[model samples]
Each structure stands twice: as C-alpha cells, then as structure tokens.
Target: MKSIYILTLLSFFVIVINLSSCDQSIDNLYTEKSRIQFKYFKEDTVTQGQATVYRRTYFDRTTLSFGMSDDEVQEDTAKIVVEFLGDVSNKDRTYRVRINPDSTTAKEGVHYKPFSSTQTFRAGRRKDTLSIVVLRKDLGTSFINPVDYRLTLDMEATEDFNLGMKDGLYTHLYMNNYLVKPKWWDGVGSLMFYHPKKWKILISFNEKWANKEKEPFNFNNGGREYFEALRNYLEREPTFDDETGARIYIDRLVEQNN
Candidate 1:
C-alpha cells in the first residue's frame, strides 16, 4: 500500500513538471519571435460618443456629443496595446510611437492634448499600452465651419523588435463633434433609440413607412429624457401610429435620462 501511494505521488509530480514545461514553451514561442504589433479586438471607451465606426483598416469615426452640458461631458481615452511576438525577454524593450494629426483643423492644445512621442514595453512583458486622452472641450466646432479631425498613430520597431504587420503598423481615428444627420432620418426631426428596440422599430418602419434610408437616428445632445421617451414610445407603438399623435404629446411625457 505504501509503494502504491509513492507511485501515485511520483506520477503527479511528473504531470506537474510536464505542464510547467509546456507553459514555458508556449510563452517562449511568442517571446522569441522578432515581431511586435497591435493587438486585435481591443476596445476603446468614449464618454461623449454614441458609436465607434471602424473602417477597413482602422477606425473610421468616433462620434461625439453635439451639445451637452459640462456635467454630461466626460474625457475619452483610447488605450492602444501592442504585443511582442515572441517570449518574454530578459532586457526591457522600448519602442517609438508617433501620433500625427492629418491636418491643422484640430490644433494641439486648442482642440486636444498632445500624446507622448514614445512608449516603452518593459522587459519580460508581452504587451504594452499607450493611452491617448481626448479632451472634451476640444471636440467642438464653430457655426462658420464644421469638420472632423483625424489622428493617426504610427508604431516603429527598435533594434530588438521588428514591426509585425505592414497593415497594422499605423491606425487612424476620427473625431466628429457635430450633429450628424442619420441617413435614415426623414427631413423632419425624428427620434433614435438604443439597440434591440431600435432594430425592431426600424424594421417595422421599413415595412410600413417604406423609407429607403434606414440608418440609426442620432439623439439630440442632452436629450436623455427625449431618448427615454422615444424608446418607451417605440416599445408601446412600434408602428408609430399617426392617430396616437405622439409628436404632439412627447415633450410633456418625458423626463431627463441623467
């Protein structure tokens, strides 16, 4: 019985050793590689935007509040993480990053704060993150001109690490603070709701109203009450019956979301 117990303990030790070795091998697989690039599926959080539209290569547009009070507006930060292709290194590695704006329309300091020109990936680590803070006050436009600002991030490899992919070496972000006319919007001002209900109302509207443009409508800034009322109204009347005269009584029935 003692011999059997000893044999079982030995087998467990062997299994643990094998598992540890496997984990080390897997870590080395990436650490030993000469490549480093952007990590995929990482999300960016925006406090003032409704949606982030990603295009073929990079981000297409980051929607911003059209008109909201100071309390409603929050600063947005984009955390971009880059990963090393190989196993953890003994020595710390540092890479250079360039944050270049496409035009002078959104000047630094006036429109947004400037980001550091370099980011370091500490030694023995597979990934490093760079944070780009977007100031809420900078995302505004004057009545004379309205335009979106484009910010691009370019990553360069050091002697220790090679640039992983050509396509992912650079990424772009657009900031648009102006009120956007939803493609689905009729000439008349209409309400847009959050998901699920928005989809249901849109489908119903398409079948009945036959409006060709079906893009999700934009909520008026500071229209949280308006948004809730529109959502509730859609829940009750997906068909948007003219007889109910929702347009006439919407403002009285709604309260602010905040």
Candidate 2:
C-alpha cells in the first residue's frame, strides 16, 4: 500500500511536469513576433494553400547601370517596394522614407531626380513602390569614369509603422551612363541589344583602348572624349597601322563612322 502511494505521488508529479512543459511549448508556438520590411517582388496574390514565403529580389546596396545606347524616348526609372512582414493590422499604415545621396558621384538634380521622402501601405495593402527616375541628359557629362554614383533610401520609424529587418532599413542605387555589360554578357555577347553591330563596334573599340592605352579608358568617365579621339585617330591613319595595326577588327568601322 505504501509502494502504491509512492507510485501515485510520483505519477501526479510526472503529470504536473508534463503539463507545465506542454504549456511552455504552447506559449512558444503562439508567440507573435510581428515585423515590417521591404518586399522585393511585385506579386499581388498568393496562391491558395501556398505558404507565404518572402523572397528578397532587391538588394541592400545595388548598382544599376544605364547605357548611353538605351532608347532616348523611353522613361528610365527604378522602383523599390516596401511591405509588411507580419500579420496585417486593421488600420492603414503610413511609412516614412528618407532619400539622401549616399555617394558623391551622383547628385539629386544631375544623375537622378529627387523622390518623395514618404510612402504609404494601406490597411489591406501589402506593399508600396518608391520610384526614382534617371535623367539621361543629366547622366551624360556629370559622372566621373569608373566611380559609381549612389543614391540611398532609408526607412524611418514612425508611430504608424516600425522598421523590421536589416534589409528593410536601407537600399541603394548606383547609376552610370556607361554601356553596361548585361547580366548575360558572357553567354550572349552583344546580341542583347537592339543594335548589335553598333554595340559590338563600341564595345570592341573600348576594349582595345582599355587594353593598350597608357591611361585607363572607360566608357563612363570621358566616353564623349574617348569616342571623339577614336574617330580622329582613325581619320589620320598614322603609318603605324601597318606597323601596329588596331587589335580589333571594329577599328575599320570606327575610322569609317565619319
């Protein structure tokens, strides 16, 4: 009977321990950690029964190059989207953003136009876009070669919304007017552009000067001057062509562009 009593007390203690552990597990399961962050993708709807997975498409700091070869008529701009990371609230949330020149290479009026310092996420809305336009005319002669001009956007904490992860706090934009080698430049070469021949010639000529010139040459810094010099060099046709011919076949076209 004493053994039975002892067993009963031990059973009760074990039951209490299990119940306490279960309670702690439940508390941890229900713990809500709400956060707000920037959403990289523009997907408006999540598929039915699909888990909500966040993919970071935007970078904390990224460089975006605008080639001088881009269509003159098309508007040039970049869009950044910010969103909530946790459960949505009943009321609309307004988030404030601050844009500042992160690097001296780019200026507000010269490389890009200023953006509004604030963005809003409606009560039911998941994300909002911040657009920054790149002025092509302003880009031509403003930046120094090889140096990247950067624009930074900082997420500000406000009563309506709180900042979330590290990525949500800041984003960067680096703009330049050089002929940017596309992401697939290695596989596809100059075929990515509409005018492949012109692109090839320009790329070929630039590569030549980059390899042989005493001073480093780049299409972004003094591209206007470099191309002008190339044209003149072709025209003069120094006897050195027979002695030290241009390495690239495109030099013939460069001399003929006149």
Candidate 3:
C-alpha cells in the first residue's frame, strides 16, 4: 500500500512537469519578431523553346541609369519599397539604413543625396518607400564611363524591429549620367544614332513629349503615322551633325542606327 502511494505521487509529479513543458512550447509558438525587407523583384515570361512560364526574379542589386533624360534633368529620385512582415501596430516605427563605404563609390552629396538617419513606417501601414535623391548635375568627368558611381545600403536592427531575411539584408545601386540607350530605342526604326545632342533634338519634335517623364515611348500613332514620319522629316531637312561633324540627315541613312 505504501509503495502504491509513492507511485501515485510520482506519476502526478511527472504529469505536472509534462504540462508545464507543453505550456512553455505554446508560449514560444505564439511569440514572433517583427521583420522588414525590400519588396523589389523583376518578372519575366519565358516561352522560347519551352512551355510558357511566368517567373519572379528577386534582386538585391540594380542599376539606377539616368541616360534617358533630356539635358535639363539634374536630379532623379529612386523609390525603394520596404515591406513589413508582421502584424500592424497602432504606433509608427522607424528603421535605419547604413552605407558600406568600402563597397560604395558614389559620393553622398555629389552623386546622390544622403539617406535620412531614420525612415518612418506609419501605423497601420504594411509597406513604405525609401526615396533616394540621385544628383546628376556637376558630375564633372566622373560620368564619362558607365557605372562610375555605386552605393551600397544595409539594414540595421533597432528597438522596433529585427532583420527579416538573410538574402534581403542589403542592396546595391549603380549610377551613371551618360546619355545611354533607352529601352525603346529599337522602335526608332533603323536610322538613328544615340548622341546626347541629337537625342535632345529628336525628342523635341513631339509636343506631347515636352514632359520627358510623361512621354509615351511607344511608336504607335493609331495606324496614322509616327516614327516613320520622324524619319521622313529628318530625311528631308537634314540637320548638320554637330556631334560627328557630319550631317546625319544623309549619313544616318548610310551609316548610323541609333
């Protein structure tokens, strides 16, 4: 009978220990740390030599090329979206971005404006954008080649939040001021060379394109006429090529495809 009583007490203590352990596991499961990451990615449709497939490609790096702008464009803004990965709160939260000088070639005040010491994530918001003002004026000879300036940004932990994913902890942005090729350059037919002086003149032909930012790069004119008209006009009234010292009106038809 005494042995039986001892076994009963021991079993009761064992059950209590298991229940306490289970409660701790439950508490740990409910607790989660807040996290934030950059929500930037590129998507592409692959249909060549295979089935049609849609894929999302995430990038921790991208180039901030300013080649498409007209001569008057001095400063451009880059919008980087940061995403919150936790439940929303009723109070605002702040985050920090540190620069890695070893990997950064762009000067803070010259190539790009410095980021604020802290950026705010408003209450009830799940996403916020970080604006980086990239300065292009007075670049001097630094922009003679492509990708002359690069800036690396890193995420830092703070009282309000913790770093999210390992892969999204940082990003790199490269900058250049050269009048590099635009995306729709091929749609210009086969007669133009992309010269800084010449591109400014070509874009002027369209009144709707006065605001280069709103300019619809598409060559469509409701089946009426558009890029071909620009070609015809240039062919008839050939401007002396100040860039090459040869009139492109005649030379382009035989020599250049900008």
Candidate 4:
C-alpha cells in the first residue's frame, strides 16, 4: 500500500513538471510572435488658415531589449510603413521623410514623394490626425514623406495585427514646422516658403578642406567665409541675370583668390 502511494506521488510530481515546462515554452512563443509594435502620433485638429504639423516616432520593446542585429529588426519592421500628410485637400501637398539607417551615421537620408490619396476636405472643421498603415512588402523602395495628405498602403499579408495609431508616439519626435501658403506661386516664384524653423546655415571657407568629398560636408571652422562671399556677391549684383550672375560671382571669386 505504501509503495502504491509513493508511486502515485511521483506520477503527480512528474505531471506538474511537464505542465510547467509546457507553460514556459508557450510564453516564449508568445514573446517571439509579437516581437515589435510600431505607433504614430499627430495633432487632432487644425484651423483652416493655420498650418498643421505632424510628427512620427517608433520604439520596439523586443528589438530594444534584445541584442538583435539591424537586419533582424528590419525584417520585422518591413511589415508596415506609416505616413503623415499635412493638408488633406490641397493638391500640391508633399510628403517628406528623414531616415537614419543606423545608429552611428549622423547624415540622415531625406526623401520627398507626392501624396497619392484622393483629397476629401471637410467644410467648416478639420480632423486633426490623419493616419494610415501599409504592409512591409508593399512599402517597396519608395521614400516615405512624414507630411502629406494622401497615403498609399499595400498590405499583402492576410494576417491581422493590431497597430497602435495614437497621438502620443509623436510627442517626442522632431517635427518640421511649415507655413501653409494659399497658392503655390504667391508672387514669390517657388520660394523656400516651407522650411524647418530650427535649421541653421553653416558656411565653410577652408581652401584645403578635404572633408567636402565625404558625407555631411563638415562645416566646422571657416565655413562662414563661403556664405559671406556668396552673400556679398548677391547683394552687390542682385539684378544680374542668372547666367551673367553666376559668371560674375565666379569671376569675383577668382579675382579674390588671385
């Protein structure tokens, strides 16, 4: 009788151990399945006359925590591409994107693409946040613009996944501030009307500078000299026609150097 009791106890312990192992395996599978989550954020509403800015940022829990290679992370990232378009109704609206391929590179890849969605403008009020998602394989080789009205998404995968499209993700990302111009040619002949507010122009004047051939033309010292020369030429000969103006500027620089 005691032997039978001991055998029964051993069987119960074995069963518990097997169940625990199975549970652990299941938990690991779940962790691997939903390895990453991408989220986007933007303003909810904007006044008709004012410009609306949208910002997007992404963070991955599994990718951040695990020491995964970039290729691996990219494999998971290819599932979706989120775009932000500024004005919905305007036909001239453009999209822009700055991509940092790796953590080490300071120079970001910039791209501008036309928005492809049909514009649908509301009469009196405007919805603040416009969001869309595309499958990774469908994103193709096109550069994604963060600000654009029409979004083109191609989702080939039949699997359904919940994506978090919230305004909080963009809270910390950098947004390009742009002015909304009523017309494209508002008497100012294709101007730099919409540029980042925080951009600073750096000039370099070193004749022997070797870094110009490399990525991110380093504007450390003496760079302002280049800008100064260009500014002086422009101010002195503001009315010079395009061909003559370029020639004069070049001649002046040659004379100055000689």
Best by TM-score: 3
- Candidate 4 residue lDDT tens string, 6-80: 999999999999999999996675342111122333245445557765544334211111111222332222122
Tens digits of per-residue lDDT for model 1 on 120-228? 7787787877666666666754322556766666778777777876755766555655444445544334353322224334344443322335533333543344445
Once superposed on the true structure, which residue ranges of model 1 sit more than 4 Å away at CA? 1-33, 40-74, 101-105, 141-146, 178-228, 231-258
Worst 10 residues of 1 by lDDT: 240-249
Q: All candidates' TM-scores? A: 0.46, 0.53, 0.64, 0.24
Q: How far is candidate 1 from the true structure (C-alpha RMSD, Å)?
A: 14.5
Residues 1-258 of candidate 3 have per-residue lDDT tens digits of: 999999999999999999999999977742675787776576889896868888898888766656666568888988777876677878989888888888998898988987785888788888887889989875532222445577888888778878887777788877776655555554545435554434555556655533333336444543125455555666776665434445555125243455
Candidate achieving higher lDDT, 2 or 3 = 3
Residue 48 lDDT in candidate 4: 52
Say which prediction, candidate 3 or candidate 4, comes out ahead on lDDT.
Answer: 3
Candidate 3 runs further than 4 Å off = 1-30, 42-54, 62-70, 140-144, 184-189, 192-225, 236-258
Which rank order by lDDT, best down to worst?
Answer: 3, 2, 1, 4
User: Which candidate should be chosen as best, given lDDT against the real structure?
Assistant: 3
- Residue pairs with colliding backbones in model 3 are 192-258, 193-258
